[model samples]
Target: MAELRLEELTAQTIVAARNLALKPGQAAFIAPETYVHVEQDLDPAGSWPRVVMDGDHLVGYVMGAFDADATEDFLKAALWRVHVEADAQGAGVGRFAVQALADEARRRGFDRLTVVWASGEAGPEEFFKAVGFEVVGETPYGENLGALAL
Candidate 1:
């Protein structure tokens, strides 16, 4: 396994980031004005957005906030989007990213964090479960909303 480094994203990095993460059906959850804008200008002192970059490639990312608008302090968060290309899946990258998000949230005073995963996607539910996130709710697409206690 290569050393996976986590870093803050800037505006210049967003396009290449899309290459690593967004693949057709994977954009709805994380693609929007608010989410990308924040990542484009990461604020270490204010906002919580982090990316897992494998060398020069963006493998996965996690963003946390209190509300769906990503602006409250109730501290509810979404894994938003997490991907590692085809060859990288099941090679420990997703698990590592999830744990990284959990660690980040815990370090930031959040007691729990939520991840809304694609329901039809194979292996993700079990992966989240293996990471200690349990299904607490469901979405229209049968997507299981899982939560991990930080």
Candidate 2:
């Protein structure tokens, strides 16, 4: 496994983050410019947009929020989006990224980290479960909701 690190999104890295790609058919799991658009709407006090790196390479992207009101009553933080470049998938980057996000949530006084993924996506379902997130419910649009108690 490569050494994975999560760094706060900076202007220099934002372009690389936007260019991170998913494998074909995996785009349905997340929108193509989510990082770009979400950054524009971030509330600095509660949202964290990070660029996931493997040494010097930009390999993934993640955005999470600690906005209590934006999540369900039981959640204290939410992992909004996570994407690993197709070449980096299955090499532990995603696991490292999610764990880093969970650590951030804990540091922010959150006891749980929640996430939602397209319901029918086998990859995300398995990935979340492998990282200790249990199926909690479903979203209005039919996304599978999962939560990890920190």
Q: Find the candidate with the highest lDDT and give its number.
A: 2
Task: List model 1 lDDT by residue over 1-150, tens digit each.
Answer: 678877777885565555664445544544433344344433334445667778876776655544433443222555655666655666777788778877876776767887666554443667778878888876545556678877
Q: What TM-score would each prediction reach against the true structure?
A: 0.68, 0.84
| Alpha-carbon shift of residue 6 in model 2 (angstroms) | 1.6
Off by over 4 Å in 2: 31-44, 121-123
What would the per-residue lDDT of candidate 2 be over residues 22-59, giving only the tens digit for each residue? 88878777732333333444456877889888889999
**Candidate 2 — worst ten consecutive residues by lDDT sum?**
31-40
Cα distance off (Å), candidate 1, residue 150: 1.6
Clashes of each: 0, 0
